[model samples]
Target: MSKIRKKKIKKTNILLGFICVLLAILLGFILVTSYKSEQKESRHLSEIADDQQSGIEDYEAVKERAKELEEISSEEAEDTEDIKSKNTEDTEKTDTAETEDADKTEDTKDTKDETAAAASGIVCWGDDLINGEESNTYSYMAVLQKLLTDNGYNMTVINKTLQGGGTLSMMKMAGVSDETIQGYITRHQQAANGAQLNVTETGIRDLTEEQTTRNDMDCIPVIFMGYYGGWNHDPAELADQQEQILNTFQNKNQFIVVGTRPMDGSVTSEALDQVLSQKWGEHYISLADVTAQPSSTYEAQQAMAEAILQKLQELNYISKN
Candidate 1:
């Protein structure tokens, strides 16, 4: 209880206080470093997503094409509703007897329209793209079919896009074996190979043509399977998965690849498209150049379909004549 003992106790307290302050400073530094690391990771993911939302270019061409197709569609609808416009125009000039004859002629035309010959069927397999979710307010495939038929080509499109399905379901629909389908998922997952944003595990696969028909050899398989790959996946990996899928086809000449743009509007795969072009030249198609709208619209769908039709003709799937 003397002065020396009291002084020793006070010095001990000071040393303990210093050690506590040093530990607190170290802890604070560690916490800040950890927080910054997490934030950087978050920013990286957000940056990747932001990047996908870019690449929407050449929008005026899409708008112009849409304007033309919409006008044609309007005229076609009027013709369908006013099939006997000539007779109506001449009704006031003719008597009741002449009108009766005209009615008979109109009846024949209606019958002919109702019993038109069956069209050559083209098969399309896709995901959300089928629903106009890709860039329009309606099924772009419908417009694609119309573009063919309205131009004197005898063709009908058969869409096999499942309403709420994914790639796995698409493969299953195509009669891919369970083992093969599983391999597809595995192949894609391996290709994805990222921290947590791999997309194949999140969505679906696609379909084919030869498997759907027993005797219809003319059916051409058109496939669009890039949504899962382009959504949150690395573009190179997406290209890899697409290459793997194409290799799975027994006869590469029998199918067409409708290249996909991610929902966020980025290009699906420039390298893959190049690879496809180098191999089969024009067997590949993409709507990215045809559209640059930030959102879907009827016009965009029509324009995209028109673009596809032009490509089909270029590729000799449809006769130029």
Candidate 2:
């Protein structure tokens, strides 16, 4: 081989070696850059995964907090309901106590009024027909009470008539045992203690010694009719018995006779009226003359009671308003 050719070959080999080394160095740089880029991407992905995990934990905490808030709300609601129920019970008890107090106060006022009235003069009435069961429209005693009250008089009217008997029975009752008569008056007072106007069916027999002495009885207006239990009584005998009863009173001037028309056609009302008028004179009052017949009827009884009240006022037996 020639020396020049050998030298040129040697130079070419050296150049080629240098070129390979440069290519290898470039490849290494490229590989290192690619690995660094991959590591950066992995770090970004890890950061994103950490953020997601944190979000999940926050969501769990929020859910737990919501559950706690709900439990608090439920407990508060139960407490509110219990408070409302207790308030309602207390209000009801207060209302009941108030009503009881009001009733007691009213009862006391009524008793006081009754006591004051009982001390004053009391008007008395008697007769089977007048003291009978009250009718739908008007009771004779009730009518009399209203008239007297309208005239500024507070009076308690008491009926002293036997259930089935007439004037004879009234006389007998007047002569009863003093203890028995006193007991009846006591019962009547007890029953009337709280009433505005007491109209009792206890007959004149209830007029005991205690009543006459303790209370000022101004007048006893008697309504006596002959007819009773579908039979007519003798007017003369009935008047005699009535007079006997009136004599028992401490003040005979308090007796006022009133005659009623017979319900039956067998007996004339004028017959009894004449007998009463002859005995009692100006003190006698005829129901038929004052109003109409059938004093048992509501309208007729009302008119008769009014007329009797007027007569009592005219005669000055009761104080005028």
Candidate 3:
């Protein structure tokens, strides 16, 4: 119980204290390293959020464009209503020369103005661009038809691909029991690589002739939307034939020609580079470009449609001449 035993106990206490200090230092180092790593992760997340904010801005730009188009469309609708009222009043008057002259003037301003008609809206033509309930081509047509209707064009958009009307739906309509109708369907099926047409060639030729005449009547400008390649045909050759068909309209002032190649990677195989590279892909109008992979919901389609409407407004189809 003397001085030597007391000194040994003091030495033991000092060694224990040294070990505890080293342990505390190691624990503090671990905690600091973990905190720094978490701070780095938080900074990285902040950067990601900033990038998403930029994307939102781009999307919002599209939205703003849609809103502008809605405003323009509303104004056009009001103008259309006023014009209809004026026209109604004119119709009630006598068929005198003054009335006729007034009518002519009005027509010149509205229907007879070739430049205005051509610039204001598009007339789309395809086998079923107007009325094939089952055709995929009609899906986009419905969208376009809705656009035209929304913008104040109130006409029944024709679907020339039906029976007794075209090669596909030739015999589906009434009183068309010509045996040649069956023959036409057979030929068309063979040409279409086993795809049957419900229409007869005679009917199609007749409809084509009728449409040709109507194109001259200044009723509505027509745009024939045909596939570039079908049944092993060359796109360039088809484009040429389409050009010829369009020329038959006589009054081609209100017509536009557009050819869409299938987007199933067949455009390259079918040698449609001329159609694709030159006139097809411009203005983002090709169905392939906009609809390769559609968004899952109507909301997305509506958003995309709105974006397209904005782009069209920018083109100024409704601007005063």
Judging by TM-score against the true structure, name the best candidate: 1
The predicted structure with the larger lDDT, 1 or 3, is 1
TM-score of every model versus the real structure: 0.46, 0.46, 0.36
Report the C-alpha lDDT of model 2 over 53-82, residue by residue, as the tens digit: 999999999999999999999999989988
Residue 321 of model 1, lDDT score = 33
Ranking the candidates on lDDT from highest down gives 2, 1, 3
Candidates by TM-score, descending order: 1, 2, 3
Task: Name the TM-score of candidate 3.
Answer: 0.36
lDDT of each: 0.59, 0.61, 0.47
Candidate 1, residue 239: Cα displacement in angstroms equals: 5.7
Clashing residue pairs in all predictions, respectively, total 5, 3, 14
User: Please, what are the lDDT tens digits per residue for candidate 1 over residues 169-280?
Assistant: 5555655467866665665556558545344445444545544433323455567665644323444544444444444443335456665555544454464465445654
Q: lDDT of candidate 2 vs native?
A: 0.61
- List the candidate 1 regions with Cα displacement exceeding 4 Å: 1-120, 128-137, 187-218, 230-254, 264-280
Best by lDDT: 2
